[model samples]
Each structure stands twice: as C-alpha cells, then as structure tokens.
Target: MTTPADVHGVREPGLPGRLLTVERDALVPLLRGRAEEDFTLPVAACPGWSVRDVLAHCSSAFTRVLEGRFEQGVFSPACNDRDIAERAEWSNQRVVDELERGMTEAGPVIAKAGGVLDILALGEWVHAGDVREAFGEPGAYAGAGLPSALSLMAYVTCRKGHLSLHADLDDADEPLRLGDISGRRPPARYIGDGPTLVRLYAGRPVDGASYELAGAEAGELNIFDE
Candidate 1:
C-alpha cells in the first residue's frame, strides 16, 4: 500500500465538540419521536444492550465527562452496568433528555481535557450508530458527522497505537491514512466504504459487508479492547 495523503488531519481542537453537536442534532430528535417500544429493541452490535441501555450508557459517560467524576475503572463493564442501573427507574424521555444535554455540554469538557479523552467522542459517535442499527434506520455510522468522526477516529487510532491502514473509500474524495502515525510498518490496504471501515475498527459485527484488507489482520485493527 502507498502512504496516505492525509494522516494528521484529525488533530483539530474543536473536532470532538463538533462531532458531538452534529450527533445531538441528528440523534436526539429521533429518540424523542420514537415509541416506547422502540427503546426496548436489542442492539445487535452491542450484545446484551437494548436501545435504552445504550442510551443510558452513553448519557452516563457524558455525564461523567461533564461532571468531572471519572472513577478509577471508568467505562468498564461493571461501571457501565452501574451507570445504567442507576438510571433504570427514569423514563426513556428523561434518559434521552440527559443524553441530549450531555452531548451538548460534554464536548467542551472533553476538548479541555486535551487529547486524553478524544476517544470518548469517537465512542459516542459509534454508539450512535449502534442505536441507529437497532432501530433499523439507515446511515448507522455514516452521516453528517461522519467527516468529523473520521477525523477524530484518525487521531484516536494513532494515539492508541493501532496498526496503520490506507483506506480507499468509495464515497470519499480521497483515501485516508489511519492508525500509527510514526509509520513504523508498511501500512495495510483497505478497499470499502466509510461505514464498513468503521465496523472493522470498532470490532462490531461485519457479517454481510464486502471489503478487502491486506497486510493486516482484522482483529489487529480494533482500537477498543472490548
């Protein structure tokens, strides 16, 4: 694979904030308009989590970020379960309301934390995809925020020291260089659309999508340990 044309493009200071805002505008209304039954739908990407569970987890994380109350093992399974459990008695609208507020307010806190918390924005964006997939709505990972999301992802992947890959996306104006910034190894090759590439990075289910990868294993590309 050739070297990517843009590898350092995701280091924008306000990117995390912009991503959160875009997602809030897109996701909050959908959550508000949905029926109560829709909140109970299972998210195939996030096993054992329904739509409400995912929303609760997302909102709780944002709440933590907004409130500056991160526990030692924050975002871990037990921590997430506790966060969701604490909100179990609230109505779905309340959960969504909190999520909307968190999405709007947490971005500035994340921005001020320097680069340490940049990945939280990416996770929030991907979790939005999980919610969309569960609701069977299109554009799960690809949307208005996709450009910012991809930029943040590039930064996150590089920061986390994942393997580098040169992606040739059908919808992109140009190829993307993601993962290791030092270019210690020859970057792998990826031919696909943006959403499928996201699926690969997030380690989410990719049963039916079509894509080609070379010089790197799919398992090695996952930025999230979980």
Candidate 2:
C-alpha cells in the first residue's frame, strides 16, 4: 500500500529537483552570508572535510551530472577527492558561485536520469545540514525540504534492499517506513525525531541523539556509508 509518504509508491520525477531548489533557497544564502573563515570549519559529520570541501564536492558532482561525466565509480571517495583537489586554487567566492549555479541547474539533469540520481539531492541536502551544525546553528538537519528528503530517503533505502525499519518520529505526522518493504523481513523499529533518523541513514555521528531501535543495529540503517 502506498502511503502519502510514498512508501510502496511511485518515484517522483520532480521530487529531487524540487529538493535541490528548496535547499538552494535556504543554503546558498546562508553560505553567502558567512565570513571567509567560516568555510574552513570542519564538518564532524564528514570528518576531514571542511565546509568549503563539502561545497566543492557538491558543485563538482552537479557539474558531472550536467556535463554527463559519469564514468565508473564516479562518486567514489577518490573521485570526490579529485574533484575537491581540482578546486583547490579557486577562490572561496568562486566555489560558492559554482555551488549556487549547480544547485540552481542540476535538477533538470537529475530529473532526466529518472530515479538513478535522486539520492544525490538528498545527500546534498544532508551535507547542507552538516554545514549548518558545524556553524552551531539550531535545527541543523531539519528544514523546509525535510519532508521531501525523507520521502526520497525511504525510496532510496527500500531500493537498496536494506533492512526494513519503521520510524515513529515525534516531529512527523505519521510513521516513516524505510528499507526492504517486502514482507519477507519484518520492519525494525525506530522512535525519535526526523533529523536523528537522517543521521542514522547518513552514517553521521549520533552519539547524543535520543532514539530507540529494535531488530536492527543503528549502523544497518546507513545508506550513504554503503
């Protein structure tokens, strides 16, 4: 049965693009407002990556999509590192400029790929949260685009054939079901807010997150780290 959240529902062709556009409205302005030194802050969610590096990687990834540059292992760590390295000499403004452009333009390209690249938009939004948290901002991982991101996440997790889990989030109107939806595996359980659920799936540090789980380890929820 397809719930309003899209569990067992059809893939939304415009959802990824909409997510990107929504995130850009929120994130690009925030990035543009920060001082030069703020970009140097390390994102704990992505160790060894400064805010600048995250932005660089995001823009470059979008550029790849726009330019149709998907080679083998395109988004591997090595490829991401190479992308960041290519931007090392660019000014901070230049990087942000490219990021703004990417966020604005990558949607159509992603939409054209059908569902193959939908996860990229969700990942980009989460990285935006990582940046927000590094800046000590409240509501780091939750925002206007969260509902859409969560919907997309459920689809991605289910498609990945991971463990099934049912999330009872305090902040959401209804439970979010993720991972293998086939009846062969009973869904695991999670009780928490939406952002913490995102933390689990993204493999971000969640030491202080207040959440409950049964039938599946927290690590098993990770889609990004896989």
List, residue by residue over 129-216, the lDDT tens digit for candidate 1. Answer: 9999998998788888887777787888877778888888877888887888686899999998888888888888788888999999
Candidate 2, residue 24: lDDT: 93
| TM-scores vs. true structure, each candidate | 0.95, 0.95
C-alpha local distance difference test of each model? 0.87, 0.87
Model 2 misplacement above 4 A: 1-4
Give candidate 1's error at residue 61 in angstroms. Answer: 0.4
User: On residues 17-122, what C-alpha lDDT tens digit does candidate 2 reach at each position?
Assistant: 8888999999988888999999999989888999999999999998998899999989999999999999999999899889888889998888888788988988
Off by over 4 Å in 1: 1-10
Worst 10-residue lDDT window for candidate 1 reads 1-10
